[model samples]
Structure formats: C-alpha cells, structure tokens
Target: MAMRRTRILFMGLALLVLACGSTSGGGDDAMASGGSPGKALYNMNCTLCHGRDGKAGLNGAKDLTTSTLTKSEMVAIVQNGKGAMAAYKQLLTPKEIEAVVDHVRTLGRKK
Candidate 1:
C-alpha cells in the first residue's frame, strides 16, 4: 500500500512537471483570436489618458473613439506630443507605436 501511494504521488508530480513545461502557443499565447498585439502595450502606457475603451479624454486627452485621424497622422502625433500629451518617440519604438495605433483604431468600432 505504501509503495502504491508513492508511485501515485510520483506520477502526479511527473504530470505536473510536464504540464508546467508545455505551452499552448508561443508569445502572446493568451491573446484572444483577432486580438491586436498592441493591446497589452496600450494598457501599460496609453490607458491613463486614453482609458481601456479609448474614451477617457482626461487631462486634455482626446476621445480616441471619435478620432478621425489617419494612421500616419496618429503615428506622427504619438511620436511628437500634442498639447498635454507627451511625445512617445523617446519612450516607445516605431513598432510599438504602430501596434498602439492599430489598437486605438479599433476602439471606435468596438461597441
């Protein structure tokens, strides 16, 4: 009986180790289907002014949901600050900027 219990415990531990080592996918595995890669980045950086839905409009922040700016236009503004907004050029990479733009563009149509 003691040996059987030990074997069962060993098996459980083995399975747990295997599960821990396994993955469903690579980077961004938890991201939803069709979800933008920039969503997380936006949450970390832009959420303060833009909010989760991009409608916060706090502290001179524009309502991104109603924004009609082109992608290039938005990128330029993000890179170079506008009014109360701080320039992200010294902070985020160009790729990060593009990702943020992609995420922000989806805000208006989310509802």
Candidate 2:
C-alpha cells in the first residue's frame, strides 16, 4: 500500500510538471500569434466579455472570431474605446495593446 501511494504521488507530480511545461509563458509565439502575455492579458481583461475563444459577446462585446478589423483599427479602438467597451489606454501600455491585438488575430484562426 505504501509503494502504491508513492507511485500515485509520483504520477501526480509528473502530471503537474507536464501541465506547467505546456504553458506558453508569453514568449514570441504569444507576441506573434497570441501565446503568452497577449493570451494572458486577453484572459484577464477580455475573456469575461469576449469569452475564452473571443465569441462570447457578453454585454454586446463583438465576436472576435468573425471580426475583420485591421490591426491598426483594433489598436485605435482599444486605445479609444468603442460604444460599450471602455478604453484600455489607461490600463495597458502600447506594447501590451499591440500584443493583445496580435492575440486577437489568433482567435480568428481557431477551428
């Protein structure tokens, strides 16, 4: 029974490590295609309304999956705010906003 318990603990630890290893860590992939900081930021600020996949539309949030807004357009909207959405200019830096825009672009590519 003790040996079985030890094996179970080892398996749990292995799973935990594997899970952590799979995370993106906000690297270049996140910057280029919404992997890390961009994904993290989106989750923190946009997910509540945009949904995990950017299609939730809670409180009139637009469906990012089908959005055709260009990067510059997205950046402007993010900085200036749309109808219901509040401007993020006060919250995120220019680089952060660009990262989020990059991330939002990835949402449309999801199958």
Candidate 3:
C-alpha cells in the first residue's frame, strides 16, 4: 500500500510539472506581435471538431467560407450558442471574438 501511494504521488507530481511546463502552441512574443488571439484560442479548443481549416465537417461543422452571417450574428452564435455550437462568452473576450470573426471571413477569399 505504501508503494502504491508513493507511485500515485509521483504520478500526480509529474503531471503537474508537465502541465506547468507546457507552453501555449506558439511563443508569447508571437502572440504579442499581432498574432490572432482568437485564431490561436480556436485552434487550441475548437480545431479538433471544427477542423484546422474551419471546414472540419465534424457533425456538420459549418463552413465559415460560406457562412452568410454578419459579424454580429457570428458573435451571437459564439456567445449565445447555436445548435451544437457551444457558447464562448465566458471563454473568449469580445476582442478575441472579433479576431476569430476576421479569421473565419478569410476562409475562401482566394477561391
């Protein structure tokens, strides 16, 4: 029992260390240099389901390239929740949401 307890304690300590040591996806300087905070946050939290390119098709994740919703509508959808999409009012700030809206708007601009 003592050995088991020691193992568990060690595991917990290791996990805590790793969590603290892990850096955000990019460097802090990068974020400060006009990096899109919304894009970074979205990439970290939403990309898996929404797709890295914003066209994941996961459970019909809407293609931002074709979304007709205005910025206000997008903000509403992000903050108030829409269909399967979760509300991010608490998770993201208005500034971050604007950044995300901007990034989403560029999905298919070249094509």
Q: Tell me the TM-score of each prediction against the true structure.
A: 0.68, 0.68, 0.63
Candidate 1 matches the true fold with a TM-score of 0.68
Q: By TM-score, highest first, what's the ranking? A: 2, 1, 3
Q: Write the per-residue lDDT of candidate 1 for residues 6-75, one digit (tens) a residue.
A: 5356445544533443433334424533545566557666777889889998888999999989999999
Which candidate model has the greater lDDT, 2 or 3?
Answer: 2
What's the CA error at residue 22 for candidate 2, in Å? 13
How displaced is residue 63 in candidate 2, in Å? 0.4
RMSD to truth, every model: 15.5, 12.7, 9.6
Clashes of 3: 0
What are the runs in model 1 whose C-alpha is more than 4 Å off?
1-33
lDDT of 3 at 13: 53
Clashing pairs in 2: 26-36, 30-35
**lDDT for 55 (candidate 2):** 93
Local accuracy of candidate 3 as per-residue lDDT tens digits, 1-111? 995565356445544533443544445426333555555555554665577677776876787767788878987887777787766666566776777677666664644
Q: Which ten residues in a row have the lowest lDDT in candidate 3?
A: 24-33
lDDT of each: 0.73, 0.73, 0.62
